[model samples]
Target: MDGERLFCDIALAARIERAEARLIAESSGAARARRGDSVGFARPFAGGVASFAEADSPFDKVAGLGFAGVPDAAELDEIERAFAELGAPVQIELCQLADAAVGAFLTGRGYRLESYENVLGRRVGDATFPDGVRYCRDDELETWLAEVADAFAVADTEGLPSHEEFPRGTVIDAMRDMAGVLRFVAERDGDFAGGASFRVTDGIAQFTGAATVPVHRRRGVQTALLRARLAVAAEAGCDIAVVTTQPGSKSQQNVQRQGFDLLYARAILVKGTSAISSSGADSRQAS
Candidate 1:
Protein backbone atom coordinates (compact mmCIF):
# COMPACT_ATOMS: atom_id res chain seq x y z
CA MET A 1 0.00 0.00 0.00
CA ASP A 2 0.93 3.64 -0.34
CA GLY A 3 2.29 5.71 2.57
CA GLU A 4 -0.98 7.40 3.49
CA ARG A 5 -3.05 4.23 3.38
CA LEU A 6 -0.51 2.35 5.47
CA PHE A 7 -0.50 5.11 8.06
CA CYS A 8 -4.28 5.21 8.22
CA ASP A 9 -4.48 1.49 8.86
CA ILE A 10 -1.92 1.73 11.62
CA ALA A 11 -3.64 4.67 13.23
CA LEU A 12 -7.03 2.98 13.15
CA ALA A 13 -5.57 -0.19 14.66
CA ALA A 14 -4.04 1.78 17.51
CA ARG A 15 -7.32 3.54 18.21
CA ILE A 16 -9.12 0.20 18.37
CA GLU A 17 -6.65 -1.03 20.95
CA ARG A 18 -7.19 2.05 23.11
CA ALA A 19 -10.96 1.64 22.88
CA GLU A 20 -10.73 -1.95 24.07
CA ALA A 21 -8.68 -0.87 27.06
CA ARG A 22 -11.29 1.73 28.01
CA LEU A 23 -14.07 -0.81 27.68
CA ILE A 24 -12.24 -3.10 30.06
CA ALA A 25 -11.89 -0.34 32.64
CA GLU A 26 -15.39 1.08 32.39
CA SER A 27 -18.05 0.06 34.94
CA SER A 28 -20.65 -2.57 34.16
CA GLY A 29 -23.10 0.18 33.35
CA ALA A 30 -20.82 1.57 30.66
CA ALA A 31 -19.87 -1.87 29.43
CA ARG A 32 -23.53 -2.63 28.96
CA ALA A 33 -23.64 0.15 26.38
CA ARG A 34 -21.34 -2.04 24.31
CA ARG A 35 -24.18 -4.59 24.07
CA GLY A 36 -21.91 -7.53 23.42
CA ASP A 37 -20.37 -5.92 20.35
CA SER A 38 -16.76 -4.90 19.66
CA VAL A 39 -17.79 -1.25 19.40
CA GLY A 40 -19.53 1.06 21.86
CA PHE A 41 -19.78 4.63 23.12
CA ALA A 42 -19.82 5.88 26.70
CA ARG A 43 -19.92 9.15 28.54
CA PRO A 44 -17.30 8.48 31.16
CA PHE A 45 -17.94 11.87 32.71
CA ALA A 46 -20.44 14.63 32.27
CA GLY A 47 -20.09 16.38 28.91
CA GLY A 48 -17.30 14.03 27.91
CA VAL A 49 -18.03 11.25 25.40
CA ALA A 50 -15.77 8.35 24.49
CA SER A 51 -16.22 6.05 21.49
CA PHE A 52 -14.23 2.87 21.12
CA ALA A 53 -14.00 -0.11 18.78
CA GLU A 54 -12.29 -3.41 19.29
CA ALA A 55 -9.17 -4.36 17.34
CA ASP A 56 -9.42 -5.45 13.66
CA SER A 57 -12.24 -3.00 13.05
CA PRO A 58 -12.09 0.13 10.88
CA PHE A 59 -14.64 2.13 12.89
CA ASP A 60 -13.44 4.33 15.81
CA LYS A 61 -14.85 4.80 19.29
CA VAL A 62 -15.53 8.49 19.89
CA ALA A 63 -13.79 8.71 23.28
CA GLY A 64 -14.01 12.49 23.31
CA LEU A 65 -15.34 15.23 20.98
CA GLY A 66 -13.07 15.27 17.92
CA PHE A 67 -14.29 12.52 15.64
CA ALA A 68 -14.52 13.35 11.92
CA GLY A 69 -17.72 14.71 10.26
CA VAL A 70 -19.18 15.81 13.59
CA PRO A 71 -22.30 17.22 11.88
CA ASP A 72 -21.40 20.90 11.46
CA ALA A 73 -19.97 23.93 13.24
CA ALA A 74 -23.08 24.04 15.45
CA GLU A 75 -22.48 20.47 16.53
CA LEU A 76 -18.85 21.27 17.21
CA ASP A 77 -19.96 24.23 19.32
CA GLU A 78 -22.36 22.01 21.23
CA ILE A 79 -19.66 19.44 21.93
CA GLU A 80 -17.21 22.10 23.08
CA ARG A 81 -19.88 23.67 25.24
CA ALA A 82 -20.59 20.35 26.85
CA PHE A 83 -16.90 19.78 27.49
CA ALA A 84 -16.53 23.25 28.97
CA GLU A 85 -19.55 22.67 31.17
CA LEU A 86 -17.93 19.53 32.54
CA GLY A 87 -14.49 21.18 32.77
CA ALA A 88 -13.00 18.47 30.60
CA PRO A 89 -11.07 18.17 27.33
CA VAL A 90 -12.48 16.70 24.13
CA GLN A 91 -10.62 14.01 22.19
CA ILE A 92 -11.44 12.34 18.84
CA GLU A 93 -9.95 10.27 16.01
CA LEU A 94 -10.46 10.35 12.24
CA CYS A 95 -9.01 8.23 9.51
CA GLN A 96 -6.91 9.65 6.70
CA LEU A 97 -9.95 9.43 4.49
CA ALA A 98 -11.69 12.14 6.50
CA ASP A 99 -12.52 15.19 4.44
CA ALA A 100 -10.50 18.39 4.58
CA ALA A 101 -13.55 20.18 5.92
CA VAL A 102 -13.22 18.11 9.08
CA GLY A 103 -9.79 19.52 9.83
CA ALA A 104 -10.73 23.01 8.71
CA PHE A 105 -13.71 23.08 11.04
CA LEU A 106 -11.63 22.18 14.08
CA THR A 107 -8.86 24.66 13.26
CA GLY A 108 -11.33 27.43 12.37
CA ARG A 109 -12.23 27.52 16.01
CA GLY A 110 -9.68 28.64 18.62
CA TYR A 111 -8.88 25.00 19.47
CA ARG A 112 -5.12 25.54 19.03
CA LEU A 113 -3.76 22.46 17.32
CA GLU A 114 -1.29 20.98 19.73
CA SER A 115 0.14 17.60 18.63
CA TYR A 116 0.47 15.62 15.39
CA GLU A 117 1.58 12.05 15.98
CA ASN A 118 2.34 9.52 13.24
CA VAL A 119 0.81 6.13 13.90
CA LEU A 120 3.04 3.35 12.63
CA GLY A 121 2.89 -0.43 12.43
CA ARG A 122 4.16 -3.63 10.83
CA ARG A 123 2.73 -7.11 10.41
CA VAL A 124 3.79 -9.93 12.77
CA GLY A 125 5.70 -11.58 9.96
CA ASP A 126 9.06 -12.90 11.04
CA ALA A 127 10.44 -13.37 14.52
CA THR A 128 13.59 -11.34 14.61
CA PHE A 129 15.00 -10.52 18.03
CA PRO A 130 17.35 -7.79 19.06
CA ASP A 131 20.63 -8.83 20.67
CA GLY A 132 21.61 -7.98 24.26
CA VAL A 133 18.12 -6.76 25.15
CA ARG A 134 16.52 -8.66 27.97
CA TYR A 135 12.74 -9.19 27.72
CA CYS A 136 10.71 -9.85 30.86
CA ARG A 137 7.14 -9.72 32.07
CA ASP A 138 8.19 -7.92 35.24
CA ASP A 139 9.55 -4.38 35.08
CA GLU A 140 10.65 -1.63 37.46
CA LEU A 141 7.47 0.40 37.12
CA GLU A 142 8.36 3.11 39.63
CA THR A 143 11.78 3.75 38.17
CA TRP A 144 10.42 3.81 34.65
CA LEU A 145 7.79 6.29 35.72
CA ALA A 146 10.43 8.57 37.18
CA GLU A 147 12.46 8.39 34.00
CA VAL A 148 9.39 9.30 31.89
CA ALA A 149 8.70 12.27 34.13
CA ASP A 150 12.29 13.40 33.82
CA ALA A 151 12.19 13.08 30.05
CA PHE A 152 9.14 15.35 29.89
CA ALA A 153 10.95 18.05 31.85
CA VAL A 154 12.35 19.28 28.54
CA ALA A 155 8.92 19.21 26.87
CA ASP A 156 6.79 22.30 26.41
CA THR A 157 5.32 23.16 29.81
CA GLU A 158 3.19 26.22 29.14
CA GLY A 159 -0.54 25.62 29.77
CA LEU A 160 -0.06 21.86 29.85
CA PRO A 161 -1.17 19.50 32.59
CA SER A 162 1.37 19.20 35.37
CA HIS A 163 2.78 15.93 36.54
CA GLU A 164 0.45 16.17 39.49
CA GLU A 165 -2.67 16.26 37.31
CA PHE A 166 -1.74 13.12 35.38
CA PRO A 167 0.67 11.61 37.82
CA ARG A 168 2.73 8.44 37.56
CA GLY A 169 0.30 6.91 40.00
CA THR A 170 -2.49 7.45 37.50
CA VAL A 171 -0.54 5.74 34.75
CA ILE A 172 0.15 2.76 36.97
CA ASP A 173 -3.52 2.52 37.80
CA ALA A 174 -4.41 2.58 34.11
CA MET A 175 -1.85 -0.09 33.37
CA ARG A 176 -3.30 -2.31 36.03
CA ASP A 177 -6.66 -2.21 34.25
CA MET A 178 -5.20 -3.31 30.93
CA ALA A 179 -5.50 -6.89 29.71
CA GLY A 180 -1.73 -7.55 29.63
CA VAL A 181 1.26 -5.24 29.69
CA LEU A 182 4.56 -6.55 28.39
CA ARG A 183 7.61 -4.57 29.46
CA PHE A 184 11.07 -4.73 27.92
CA VAL A 185 14.02 -3.11 29.60
CA ALA A 186 17.48 -2.83 28.06
CA GLU A 187 20.37 -2.72 30.47
CA ARG A 188 24.03 -2.39 29.83
CA ASP A 189 26.55 -3.36 32.47
CA GLY A 190 23.64 -3.83 34.88
CA ASP A 191 22.56 -0.20 34.41
CA PHE A 192 19.18 0.77 33.01
CA ALA A 193 19.34 2.09 29.46
CA GLY A 194 15.76 2.23 28.11
CA GLY A 195 12.41 0.43 28.09
CA ALA A 196 8.88 0.22 26.60
CA SER A 197 5.42 -1.06 27.54
CA PHE A 198 3.20 -3.11 25.20
CA ARG A 199 -0.50 -3.23 26.13
CA VAL A 200 -2.64 -5.67 24.17
CA THR A 201 -6.34 -5.20 23.46
CA ASP A 202 -8.47 -7.37 21.16
CA GLY A 203 -5.49 -8.85 19.32
CA ILE A 204 -3.80 -5.52 18.69
CA ALA A 205 -0.96 -4.43 20.96
CA GLN A 206 -0.06 -0.79 21.50
CA PHE A 207 3.45 0.35 22.31
CA THR A 208 3.35 3.14 24.86
CA GLY A 209 5.73 5.00 27.22
CA ALA A 210 9.00 4.19 25.47
CA ALA A 211 11.95 6.06 26.88
CA THR A 212 15.74 5.98 27.16
CA VAL A 213 17.60 7.88 29.80
CA PRO A 214 19.73 10.83 28.61
CA VAL A 215 22.81 8.89 29.57
CA HIS A 216 22.02 6.16 27.09
CA ARG A 217 21.21 8.08 23.89
CA ARG A 218 22.48 6.73 20.50
CA ARG A 219 23.22 3.35 22.05
CA GLY A 220 20.37 1.57 20.20
CA VAL A 221 18.34 1.08 23.36
CA GLN A 222 15.17 2.47 21.82
CA THR A 223 15.45 0.26 18.75
CA ALA A 224 16.03 -2.77 20.91
CA LEU A 225 12.99 -1.94 22.98
CA LEU A 226 10.80 -1.86 19.82
CA ARG A 227 12.04 -5.21 18.58
CA ALA A 228 11.52 -6.95 21.88
CA ARG A 229 8.04 -5.51 22.27
CA LEU A 230 6.98 -6.47 18.75
CA ALA A 231 8.19 -10.00 19.29
CA VAL A 232 6.13 -10.29 22.44
CA ALA A 233 3.05 -8.92 20.68
CA ALA A 234 3.45 -11.41 17.88
CA GLU A 235 3.78 -14.28 20.31
CA ALA A 236 0.63 -13.13 22.12
CA GLY A 237 -1.37 -13.83 18.90
CA CYS A 238 -1.49 -10.23 17.84
CA ASP A 239 -1.74 -9.70 14.09
CA ILE A 240 -0.36 -6.19 14.31
CA ALA A 241 1.15 -3.67 16.72
CA VAL A 242 0.98 0.13 16.63
CA VAL A 243 2.89 3.09 18.07
CA THR A 244 2.61 6.87 17.76
CA THR A 245 5.53 9.24 17.68
CA GLN A 246 6.09 12.88 16.97
CA PRO A 247 6.58 13.53 13.28
CA GLY A 248 10.25 13.55 12.22
CA SER A 249 11.33 12.61 15.74
CA LYS A 250 13.98 10.00 16.44
CA SER A 251 11.37 7.51 17.53
CA GLN A 252 9.64 7.87 14.17
CA GLN A 253 12.86 7.11 12.33
CA ASN A 254 13.53 4.11 14.52
CA VAL A 255 10.05 2.69 13.98
CA GLN A 256 10.42 3.13 10.22
CA ARG A 257 13.71 1.27 10.32
CA GLN A 258 12.00 -1.56 12.13
CA GLY A 259 9.58 -1.99 9.16
CA PHE A 260 6.65 0.02 10.51
CA ASP A 261 4.76 2.16 7.99
CA LEU A 262 3.61 5.61 8.99
CA LEU A 263 -0.12 6.28 9.21
CA TYR A 264 -1.92 9.61 9.06
CA ALA A 265 -1.22 12.28 11.64
CA ARG A 266 -3.75 13.69 14.14
CA ALA A 267 -3.57 17.12 15.75
CA ILE A 268 -3.83 17.45 19.54
CA LEU A 269 -5.59 20.56 20.82
CA VAL A 270 -5.78 21.52 24.48
CA LYS A 271 -8.50 23.65 26.04
CA GLY A 272 -6.20 24.45 28.95
CA THR A 273 -7.21 28.02 29.72
CA SER A 274 -10.32 26.90 31.57
CA ALA A 275 -8.48 24.07 33.24
CA ILE A 276 -5.71 26.36 34.39
CA SER A 277 -8.11 28.93 35.69
CA SER A 278 -10.00 26.30 37.67
CA SER A 279 -6.75 24.84 39.04
CA GLY A 280 -5.60 28.26 40.29
CA ALA A 281 -8.75 28.54 42.41
CA ASP A 282 -7.97 25.26 44.13
CA SER A 283 -4.35 26.31 44.69
CA ARG A 284 -5.42 29.58 46.26
CA GLN A 285 -7.87 27.83 48.57
CA ALA A 286 -5.18 25.34 49.68
CA SER A 287 -2.65 28.05 50.38
Candidate 2:
Protein backbone atom coordinates (compact mmCIF):
# COMPACT_ATOMS: atom_id res chain seq x y z
CA MET A 1 0.00 0.00 0.00
CA ASP A 2 1.23 3.51 -0.89
CA GLY A 3 0.45 7.02 0.39
CA GLU A 4 0.21 8.85 -2.91
CA ARG A 5 -3.49 8.15 -3.49
CA LEU A 6 -4.58 7.39 0.08
CA PHE A 7 -6.24 10.13 2.11
CA CYS A 8 -8.74 10.75 4.87
CA ASP A 9 -11.13 13.36 3.51
CA ILE A 10 -14.81 13.94 2.94
CA ALA A 11 -14.33 12.84 -0.66
CA LEU A 12 -12.90 9.56 0.60
CA ALA A 13 -15.68 9.27 3.17
CA ALA A 14 -18.25 9.70 0.45
CA ARG A 15 -16.80 6.79 -1.49
CA ILE A 16 -16.80 4.53 1.56
CA GLU A 17 -20.30 5.55 2.64
CA ARG A 18 -21.74 5.07 -0.81
CA ALA A 19 -20.24 1.60 -1.04
CA GLU A 20 -21.62 0.63 2.34
CA ALA A 21 -25.08 2.00 1.57
CA ARG A 22 -25.19 0.02 -1.65
CA LEU A 23 -24.13 -3.15 0.13
CA ILE A 24 -26.90 -2.75 2.70
CA ALA A 25 -29.39 -2.23 -0.09
CA GLU A 26 -28.21 -5.37 -1.81
CA SER A 27 -28.45 -7.35 1.40
CA SER A 28 -31.95 -6.16 2.04
CA GLY A 29 -33.04 -6.88 -1.51
CA ALA A 30 -31.59 -10.39 -1.33
CA ALA A 31 -33.30 -11.11 1.99
CA ARG A 32 -34.91 -14.51 1.84
CA ALA A 33 -38.61 -15.13 2.37
CA ARG A 34 -39.09 -17.64 5.11
CA ARG A 35 -42.08 -18.46 7.26
CA GLY A 36 -40.94 -16.52 10.31
CA ASP A 37 -38.52 -14.02 8.78
CA SER A 38 -39.26 -10.40 9.59
CA VAL A 39 -39.01 -9.46 5.89
CA GLY A 40 -35.97 -7.20 5.63
CA PHE A 41 -35.94 -4.04 3.51
CA ALA A 42 -33.81 -0.95 2.79
CA ARG A 43 -35.09 2.57 2.24
CA PRO A 44 -32.99 5.34 0.71
CA PHE A 45 -33.65 8.55 2.63
CA ALA A 46 -31.91 11.91 2.60
CA GLY A 47 -28.40 10.78 1.70
CA GLY A 48 -28.22 7.16 2.75
CA VAL A 49 -30.04 3.89 3.30
CA ALA A 50 -32.12 2.80 6.29
CA SER A 51 -32.20 -0.98 6.46
CA PHE A 52 -33.86 -3.65 8.55
CA ALA A 53 -32.56 -7.19 8.34
CA GLU A 54 -34.85 -8.37 11.15
CA ALA A 55 -35.59 -7.23 14.69
CA ASP A 56 -32.32 -6.80 16.63
CA SER A 57 -30.18 -8.09 13.78
CA PRO A 58 -26.85 -6.19 13.67
CA PHE A 59 -27.72 -5.47 10.06
CA ASP A 60 -30.82 -3.63 11.19
CA LYS A 61 -29.91 0.06 11.18
CA VAL A 62 -29.37 3.21 9.13
CA ALA A 63 -26.02 3.37 7.35
CA GLY A 64 -24.42 6.08 5.20
CA LEU A 65 -27.05 8.59 6.32
CA GLY A 66 -26.67 12.34 5.77
CA PHE A 67 -23.67 12.10 3.47
CA ALA A 68 -25.42 13.83 0.64
CA GLY A 69 -26.92 16.46 2.97
CA VAL A 70 -28.89 16.96 6.17
CA PRO A 71 -32.47 15.79 6.12
CA ASP A 72 -35.63 17.82 6.57
CA ALA A 73 -38.03 17.16 9.46
CA ALA A 74 -40.26 15.12 7.20
CA GLU A 75 -37.43 12.86 6.12
CA LEU A 76 -36.40 12.21 9.72
CA ASP A 77 -40.03 11.54 10.67
CA GLU A 78 -40.44 8.99 7.91
CA ILE A 79 -37.22 7.21 8.88
CA GLU A 80 -38.46 6.88 12.45
CA ARG A 81 -41.85 5.74 11.26
CA ALA A 82 -40.39 2.97 9.11
CA PHE A 83 -38.57 1.46 12.05
CA ALA A 84 -41.51 2.09 14.36
CA GLU A 85 -43.79 0.09 12.10
CA LEU A 86 -41.44 -2.85 12.57
CA GLY A 87 -41.34 -2.39 16.35
CA ALA A 88 -37.59 -1.69 16.19
CA PRO A 89 -35.56 1.28 17.33
CA VAL A 90 -34.13 3.65 14.80
CA GLN A 91 -30.33 3.16 14.78
CA ILE A 92 -28.11 5.43 12.73
CA GLU A 93 -24.43 4.87 12.04
CA LEU A 94 -23.68 8.53 11.53
CA CYS A 95 -20.32 9.33 9.98
CA GLN A 96 -18.30 12.04 11.73
CA LEU A 97 -17.86 13.81 8.40
CA ALA A 98 -21.59 13.88 7.69
CA ASP A 99 -23.27 17.25 7.55
CA ALA A 100 -23.00 18.84 11.01
CA ALA A 101 -26.61 19.91 10.89
CA VAL A 102 -27.71 16.27 10.83
CA GLY A 103 -26.12 15.57 14.20
CA ALA A 104 -28.05 18.42 15.78
CA PHE A 105 -31.20 17.19 14.11
CA LEU A 106 -30.73 13.73 15.56
CA THR A 107 -29.99 15.09 19.02
CA GLY A 108 -33.10 17.28 18.90
CA ARG A 109 -35.10 14.19 18.05
CA GLY A 110 -33.83 12.44 21.21
CA TYR A 111 -31.32 10.08 19.67
CA ARG A 112 -28.73 9.11 22.29
CA LEU A 113 -25.19 8.07 21.65
CA GLU A 114 -24.78 4.32 21.84
CA SER A 115 -21.20 3.56 20.75
CA TYR A 116 -18.46 4.33 18.25
CA GLU A 117 -16.58 2.41 15.56
CA ASN A 118 -13.45 3.28 13.60
CA VAL A 119 -12.95 2.97 9.89
CA LEU A 120 -9.40 2.10 8.84
CA GLY A 121 -8.06 2.28 5.32
CA ARG A 122 -4.92 1.62 3.23
CA ARG A 123 -4.04 1.95 -0.41
CA VAL A 124 -4.36 -1.39 -2.22
CA GLY A 125 -1.07 -1.31 -4.07
CA ASP A 126 0.49 -4.72 -3.62
CA ALA A 127 0.59 -7.45 -1.02
CA THR A 128 2.09 -10.87 -0.77
CA PHE A 129 -0.58 -13.55 -0.54
CA PRO A 130 -0.07 -15.39 2.69
CA ASP A 131 0.32 -19.12 2.59
CA GLY A 132 -2.65 -21.23 3.79
CA VAL A 133 -5.08 -18.46 2.86
CA ARG A 134 -6.99 -18.36 -0.39
CA TYR A 135 -10.20 -17.21 -1.99
CA CYS A 136 -13.17 -19.40 -1.04
CA ARG A 137 -14.23 -21.71 -3.82
CA ASP A 138 -17.85 -21.76 -4.92
CA ASP A 139 -18.31 -25.27 -3.53
CA GLU A 140 -16.97 -24.15 -0.14
CA LEU A 141 -19.20 -21.09 0.27
CA GLU A 142 -21.47 -22.63 2.92
CA THR A 143 -18.57 -24.02 4.88
CA TRP A 144 -16.79 -20.68 4.80
CA LEU A 145 -19.94 -18.89 5.92
CA ALA A 146 -20.47 -21.36 8.75
CA GLU A 147 -16.93 -20.88 9.99
CA VAL A 148 -17.23 -17.09 10.02
CA ALA A 149 -20.65 -17.15 11.72
CA ASP A 150 -19.41 -19.52 14.39
CA ALA A 151 -16.43 -17.32 15.18
CA PHE A 152 -18.51 -14.15 15.38
CA ALA A 153 -21.05 -15.84 17.68
CA VAL A 154 -18.38 -15.66 20.36
CA ALA A 155 -17.47 -12.05 21.00
CA ASP A 156 -13.79 -11.18 21.37
CA THR A 157 -13.02 -10.53 25.02
CA GLU A 158 -10.11 -8.18 24.28
CA GLY A 159 -12.52 -5.53 22.98
CA LEU A 160 -15.66 -3.84 24.17
CA PRO A 161 -18.37 -6.45 24.03
CA SER A 162 -20.77 -6.35 21.12
CA HIS A 163 -24.07 -4.62 21.87
CA GLU A 164 -25.86 -7.55 20.30
CA GLU A 165 -25.58 -11.33 20.22
CA PHE A 166 -27.24 -12.93 17.24
CA PRO A 167 -28.22 -16.55 16.80
CA ARG A 168 -25.88 -18.64 14.64
CA GLY A 169 -28.54 -19.01 11.97
CA THR A 170 -29.23 -15.30 12.00
CA VAL A 171 -25.58 -14.54 11.37
CA ILE A 172 -25.46 -16.99 8.49
CA ASP A 173 -28.67 -15.64 6.99
CA ALA A 174 -27.45 -12.09 7.31
CA MET A 175 -24.19 -12.96 5.58
CA ARG A 176 -26.04 -14.79 2.85
CA ASP A 177 -28.01 -11.65 2.19
CA MET A 178 -24.92 -9.69 1.09
CA ALA A 179 -24.65 -9.77 -2.66
CA GLY A 180 -21.46 -9.73 -4.78
CA VAL A 181 -19.01 -10.24 -1.92
CA LEU A 182 -15.81 -12.24 -2.36
CA ARG A 183 -15.15 -14.72 0.42
CA PHE A 184 -11.86 -16.15 1.64
CA VAL A 185 -10.86 -19.06 3.80
CA ALA A 186 -7.72 -19.56 5.91
CA GLU A 187 -6.53 -23.01 6.71
CA ARG A 188 -4.15 -24.37 9.32
CA ASP A 189 -2.70 -27.79 8.69
CA GLY A 190 -5.32 -28.25 5.99
CA ASP A 191 -8.19 -27.50 8.39
CA PHE A 192 -10.47 -24.48 8.13
CA ALA A 193 -9.22 -21.92 10.63
CA GLY A 194 -10.83 -18.62 9.65
CA GLY A 195 -12.76 -16.69 7.02
CA ALA A 196 -12.95 -13.14 5.62
CA SER A 197 -14.62 -11.21 2.85
CA PHE A 198 -14.52 -7.94 0.87
CA ARG A 199 -16.71 -6.24 -1.71
CA VAL A 200 -15.30 -3.87 -4.32
CA THR A 201 -17.30 -0.94 -5.60
CA ASP A 202 -15.75 1.68 -7.87
CA GLY A 203 -12.19 0.99 -6.70
CA ILE A 204 -12.99 0.99 -3.00
CA ALA A 205 -12.71 -2.44 -1.40
CA GLN A 206 -14.68 -2.70 1.82
CA PHE A 207 -13.67 -5.50 4.12
CA THR A 208 -17.11 -6.57 5.25
CA GLY A 209 -16.02 -8.80 8.12
CA ALA A 210 -13.66 -11.57 9.19
CA ALA A 211 -13.14 -13.91 12.12
CA THR A 212 -10.89 -16.69 13.36
CA VAL A 213 -12.31 -19.57 15.34
CA PRO A 214 -11.61 -19.99 19.08
CA VAL A 215 -8.88 -22.55 18.51
CA HIS A 216 -7.24 -20.43 15.86
CA ARG A 217 -7.15 -17.09 17.66
CA ARG A 218 -3.71 -15.45 17.83
CA ARG A 219 -2.35 -17.89 15.27
CA GLY A 220 -2.09 -15.19 12.57
CA VAL A 221 -5.03 -16.66 10.67
CA GLN A 222 -6.84 -13.35 10.42
CA THR A 223 -3.66 -11.57 9.36
CA ALA A 224 -3.13 -14.09 6.62
CA LEU A 225 -6.71 -13.73 5.50
CA LEU A 226 -6.33 -9.96 5.49
CA ARG A 227 -3.18 -10.04 3.40
CA ALA A 228 -4.74 -12.47 0.96
CA ARG A 229 -7.71 -10.17 0.51
CA LEU A 230 -5.50 -7.13 0.08
CA ALA A 231 -3.53 -8.93 -2.60
CA VAL A 232 -6.71 -9.82 -4.39
CA ALA A 233 -8.08 -6.33 -4.04
CA ALA A 234 -5.00 -4.89 -5.72
CA GLU A 235 -5.27 -7.40 -8.53
CA ALA A 236 -8.90 -6.42 -9.00
CA GLY A 237 -7.90 -2.77 -9.63
CA CYS A 238 -8.97 -1.50 -6.23
CA ASP A 239 -7.01 1.55 -5.04
CA ILE A 240 -8.18 1.42 -1.44
CA ALA A 241 -9.48 -1.07 1.13
CA VAL A 242 -11.40 -0.17 4.27
CA VAL A 243 -12.61 -2.00 7.35
CA THR A 244 -14.62 -0.98 10.41
CA THR A 245 -13.52 -2.03 13.89
CA GLN A 246 -14.40 -1.31 17.48
CA PRO A 247 -12.20 1.49 18.82
CA GLY A 248 -9.25 0.33 20.93
CA SER A 249 -10.05 -3.32 20.20
CA LYS A 250 -7.65 -6.02 19.11
CA SER A 251 -9.18 -5.91 15.66
CA GLN A 252 -8.23 -2.25 15.39
CA GLN A 253 -4.71 -2.98 16.55
CA ASN A 254 -4.35 -5.83 14.10
CA VAL A 255 -5.27 -3.72 11.09
CA GLN A 256 -3.10 -0.83 12.21
CA ARG A 257 -0.18 -3.20 12.43
CA GLN A 258 -0.76 -3.97 8.77
CA GLY A 259 -0.25 -0.29 7.78
CA PHE A 260 -3.89 0.83 7.95
CA ASP A 261 -4.60 4.32 9.25
CA LEU A 262 -7.46 5.53 11.40
CA LEU A 263 -9.53 7.16 8.70
CA TYR A 264 -12.65 8.22 10.59
CA ALA A 265 -15.25 7.06 13.08
CA ARG A 266 -19.00 6.67 13.10
CA ALA A 267 -21.04 7.39 16.17
CA ILE A 268 -23.74 4.81 16.65
CA LEU A 269 -26.75 6.82 17.72
CA VAL A 270 -30.21 5.47 18.30
CA LYS A 271 -33.72 6.54 19.25
CA GLY A 272 -36.40 4.34 20.73
CA THR A 273 -36.43 1.64 23.41
CA SER A 274 -33.63 -0.63 22.27
CA ALA A 275 -31.39 -1.59 25.18
CA ILE A 276 -27.84 -0.51 24.37
CA SER A 277 -25.48 -1.47 27.14
CA SER A 278 -22.98 1.19 28.20
CA SER A 279 -20.05 -1.20 27.85
CA GLY A 280 -20.92 -2.50 24.42
CA ALA A 281 -20.21 -1.29 20.90
CA ASP A 282 -21.78 -1.70 17.47
CA SER A 283 -19.03 -3.03 15.22
CA ARG A 284 -18.60 -6.23 13.26
CA GLN A 285 -16.28 -8.84 14.72
CA ALA A 286 -13.13 -8.59 12.58
CA SER A 287 -10.56 -10.51 14.63
Best by TM-score: 2
Instruction: Give stretches of model 2 more than 4 Å off.
Output: 1-5, 32-38, 277-283
lDDT for each residue of candidate 2 in 1-80, tens digit (9 for 90 to 100): 37553569998898899888888877776774433564757888777888887766677888987677777789779878
Q: In order, what lDDT does every prediction score? A: 0.50, 0.80
Candidate 1 deviant stretches above 4 angstroms: 1-82, 85-95, 99-101, 107-110, 135-139, 152-179, 270-287
List TM-score per model, in order: 0.64, 0.92
Q: What is the C-alpha RMSD of each candidate to the true structure, in Å?
A: 9.1, 2.3
Model 1, residue 280: what's the lDDT? Answer: 11
Give per-residue CA lDDT, model 1, range 1-287, as digits (tens). 21222434434643553443354335222333434543333443222234222221111123322333344566556656654454455544433434556556655665555444456777665466777677543456666545544443332222222212233443333333333456666787788776666777667767755766667767787788887877777678887777766566666777788788875554544443422211211000000
Error of 2 at 168 (Å): 1.6
Query: By TM-score, how accurate is candidate 1?
Result: 0.64
How much lDDT does candidate 2 score? Answer: 0.80
